[model samples]
Target: MDDLVINNLSNKGIRTGKQYLEGLRDDRNVWIHGRKVQDVTNENGLKSCAHTLANFIDRQHEPKYINHLTYLDDDGDRCALAFKTPKSKEDIKDRGKSYYEWAKWSNGYFGRTPDYKNASLMSFASASTFLEKGIKGQGGKVMAQNMVNYYNYVRKNDKVLTHTLVNPTYNHQQGYKGKFSEKVALQVIKETDAGIIVNGARLLATLGPLADEIEVFPSTVLKATPDNIPFAFAFALPIATKGLRLICRDSYDLGKSHFDAPLSSRYEEMDAVIIFDNVLVPWERIFMYGEPELCNPAFSATNAVVHMMHQVACLKLAKSEFMVGLMTSIVKASGRDKDLYTKGLIAEVMQMTESIRALLFSAEEQAHEDQFGNYIPLRYPLETSRNLYPRMYPRMVEILQLLGASSLMATPSEADFANEISEDVEKYFQLSNLDSKNRVAMFRLAHDVAISGFGSRQALYERYFFGPPALMASSYYDLYNKDELMERIDSLLSE
Candidate 1:
């Protein structure tokens, strides 16, 4: 372990926080609203979020956080904890701690943090056989090598990768059976000795503008037919790749002071629709191509979903914990902690927090070893976290709104406390315990969490982050085992 730590400290491939920031100054084509972003590193709407991620990277070199954020690899090179492929119970625990630590930086609001894709790459590396099995050709060995190389490249460099999995929903009413439009979804337009030329678009590439690379994969189920083959491919490319364009939604950062828009000001992870105009995906970058059958079960078959959700479970736990803190502080400051109704509401929030923590621990405790010898968190519990949290998150937001109540509306902006009406504002808004400024700040944070554009986006993002709740529940039902309960009932009837 010490060697691993030492190796990471000395590895050139491992980028410092400053290096990470500087790397984003590339000529990537990123358009927000109508304007093309020249440099994401310095863009006002993107720089703060990029800086937030850079801080996480910087922490790896800080003595206080280095151990918690990173580990030395088998080769004795230091790597981010998120890139570690768990081979034991301890490894999972260590990785979980790192995931929790990173999630805390954004209070679990930034969903596309580097750790998210790092876990995916770790999963892909562990289950390289899946990649080999999915591809058909004389180039099977070459494809396998590519997967290994890509995984190593990402882990070594600690690359920040954003993914676009779902196709645009433009013609969803026509459904999958109708003639598939080539222009609407990313598809292989031409194949060459150099690589494949991919064209069309994909939606919801969270953090696309700020990432080092963009990974494209299948998110929705696909038919195992020739018509869908062109769209079943998966690959990763540098964000600077020519002809690749990211058309972003409006910036939510709003340039508000941190005291005013606490979450959004620092954690606005921009989401965009990616358009590939004959983008070249090198042969070495392609993971799966011309295979819809493999694309559909890519997550389950590779156990990537479980690993990815392990990171998300840690994130949800952090979010719930943050909510618990917010609710407690709100109730205490408002002098409502003693109220039975208030206590009940706060307890409900606590229960949700503990529920997420319980699932996280249970999944780690009952960890299973995959065919590749990686110790993965138990699928059922992790999946349960993924399924239940979407439902729980909105309620958690509502509880904040309820606890804050009218106080949420009464708070003044940060400017009010700093300007001409400072004395008058402070006199009127000061709470019994918290200073007026602090009280206002707390409410401002609450408002950002509950009422602002940032707050609303967080709710909607969590709701459909893993797709529709009902579909996920039904899928879980179909995947889960019922044989034991049925057998017990049969035995009872026979007796």
Candidate 2:
């Protein structure tokens, strides 16, 4: 009886493209060209996406998922995907399992679903309880309120939220020699009676266009200084705010037919280059300001790293499981099911999927309680999985490409099949006993997963997506107790 599908989001009182457009027409901060984006919810590219994501949130209202997919916060309202700080270890495991269930259903295509933000925000709430003295911007009263307010808003009304964190450019070391030492980063250009006005830019906001709301936070990439203090602020704003222009990266679609560019047409969720020109952050919306010391550590203290690692790892595992299933199905379809070599390859894919799942499970099961009373995934296994996933994912793609053979490249476009030349194309490319369309779909899906721009971006995202590898490795070394391991060696030597 529950409308759990992506398209059935209307029953939950979510605003459509039409409604969202009306809200943005007056927002001065948002611009697509010299002209302002009058109606984001109704725009050519932005409308469909905004509606699609709003529909996703509406699914949380259905009875079957309403219980497992959402939870009641301190205010006694049921909020979907609002992070539930586990009171016990089971809570941590349950949250991971819940996220995995969602990913399995979506096939991992909906990466920045509301659930992702909910979990991270929940962690922030849990961690804020442990604000010891002088721990940078330790006692975050506003962050706590922000989490609750945003959760409440999204719960009652279907609101789409996106976040912009990282600094705009990475070439700063070579480009800004004098400014770097003097803190030439996006510093506080000016302060105002109402709030601070910031000038500079943030990079790679991912889900900006689809979101109704945008949360700006200081990413770890920006080093703090007195000059960079203004840049250290965090605030929330409507996506259509004036002076906020999104310069999207080059389209990866390349005008290829949808069949050939399957992932690009639908899975192009990542957006880059969020430019801010004298953007104002209202006092109520500002969670942090001028406390440059708190920027990096404050962002980290939310346990966002562990949350993202868990979130994506679950999605990746789900995707890998689907991939393994498809490969096995294809092997059978191609009548190579009995071939020992083919069976070995299928088994290898299954093994990789299982390994990822095992790591995820280990991270969940061994989660420890943080000082804030929120349970965090065991850092070592989660970090290990995060580090290993980037490298292993590319190898997995190679495996798919290899198994696909030249068949992947030889597939005809959907238009070709629909045209009068269908017979000729079908005759040449039809595989062992399979229909032409079925074969094309299989190969197209493989290409989408293996070699397309979407696939390449995924590889890059996996690598630097969750912060630097060296930092991850360092955190592993820092959080891990080396003394425990050494004690075993000491015992053996003493004996």
Candidate 3:
């Protein structure tokens, strides 16, 4: 492939699904376990997932879905709805609708879909001044231009971005004493006329291997010392850039049939640690650099947290709805729908579903314009949903286990249904309404959702994806308005 053409393609209008898939065949440094993965598009554990994401890209071109998934830019070229910064209540609702469409495609299982980072990019672009505050010298104007340019590049090209914002874990004792390796967290190694050279690693890049670009930003508070200044930079770079490596975790997609490992088979958005070994981030890609004071507040200051959480709220609602559907199906298939305990468990799941749905509606209905004149979902409701869902998700999984019970354990693989003992298995496993094969398939899905490794990862992802619940709760408390209530109490006491 011609490097110049490849680099310049971002100026072209939106890529089709096929184009998106083809783009992933570029030279990217990716490793899974001990083996180097040559191409994620053809890797055994990653291809299906790559295709699933491609299908989402394709949805933008399909007439039936185009209206819901995309909108025309000011330049009159069609762009993804996810990239449209909401300026009105209707725009906020439309973005929510687009998020819903993508979330449903994965049944809310794929957490790092393109729309996730789209929210982030949109937020950063809308608040480009925040980037300016962090930049020094004559680079401030250049950095601000880079922000606009990158945002336009992504939105126009309909790029898929995965961000790595967490520092890799090293010995805390050593890190606190400034004795840790410079590579423990992503840091600028040197700056040149061309751009900045970065060498280090970042953790938990959810879709690192499959993404078109990788965003390295600050997610945690940083000390404003000179030692911490190197680690406070933020930038975006193409995944195909030389020396950028992705060390992936174990893939849950075990090449099992969809009938057996339903969720994992189609929706494993692989997480990996991103290592930048002297990776060159061109001048146009650097958003912020060397300002620790501004790094920590980048997300909050730009309102990116709220925008990203709004997308997450939509995804969580879909997940809750999926859990409800799965639980209802399990109860009916097992002929326990009439049982009081079963009804109660199902109701609990239903309540969770309705609660998330209500929060989603509230967030949109009460949406307010931010300082940038972009309409953002109600922060309080979205933050509350973020805090509550982490707690609710674990219980939802437990409910699935309870409702599934022995049926979940007794299920056989899809192959078993075609084997020599198929007759005996069918005779014994058949439910009253659902046939043996169908019943087993349903349980297999339940197992994938509640009992499998994929299920466990989902539980953990929900628990910590947005940081600690206690911190979020405290943040809500800190940010909430309490003056009116306190004043009313004082008035009553005085009277």
lDDT of each: 0.83, 0.65, 0.84
What residue pairs clash in candidate 2, if any at all?
A: 28-241, 28-242, 29-241, 29-242, 29-243, 29-244, 30-241, 30-242, 83-118
Q: Which stretches of candidate 3 lie over 4 Å from their true place?
A: 1-11, 136-138, 171-183, 488-495
Q: What is the lDDT of residue 438 in candidate 3?
A: 88
C-alpha RMSD by candidate, in order: 4.0, 5.6, 2.3
Q: For every model shown, what is its TM-score relative to the native structure? A: 0.94, 0.83, 0.94
**Cα lDDT, model 1, residue 196:** 95
Residue-level lDDT tens digits of model 1 in 37-141: 988978878888999888877877888888878888887788888888888988888888888988887789889878889998889877887778766755555
lDDT of 2 by residue, 1-495 (tens): 111111222323333444444444544334443444655555554444455555555566668777777777565656554456677777777778778877876577667776676666556545654222222545466555654555445444455567877664535563333122223234457778866677777666776766667778766644455555555666777666667777665445454555766655555564756777777766556666666566557656768668867887888898788778778767777898899988887788788888888898888888888766667887667777777777777777778887888877877788888789989877877678687788887888787777777777777776676666776777677777789899999999999
Tens digits of per-residue lDDT for model 3, 1-495:
233122353445667889999889998989996899988999988888999888877777888888888888887888878788899999999999999888888879999888889998989988887676656655666787778777887887778899887776677665545333574777888989978898888888888899998888875557777888888778888888889889998999998888989999998889898888898777777788888777777888899999899899899989999998888887787688899999998899889888888988999999888998889888888888898999999999999998888888998877877899888888999988799988988899999889888899999999988875766788789888999999999999999
Best by lDDT: 3
Rank by lDDT, highest first.
3, 1, 2
Give candidate 2 misplaced runs (Cα > 4 Å).
Answer: 1-48, 72-76, 130-151, 154-158, 170-185, 221-228, 253-262, 486-495
Cα error, residue 340 of model 2, in Å, equals 4.2
Question: Which candidate would rank higher by TM-score, 1 or 2?
Answer: 1
TM-score for candidate 3, please give it. Answer: 0.94
lDDT, candidate 2, at 130: 26
Worst 10 residues of 3 by lDDT: 1-10
What is the lDDT for 334 in model 3? 66
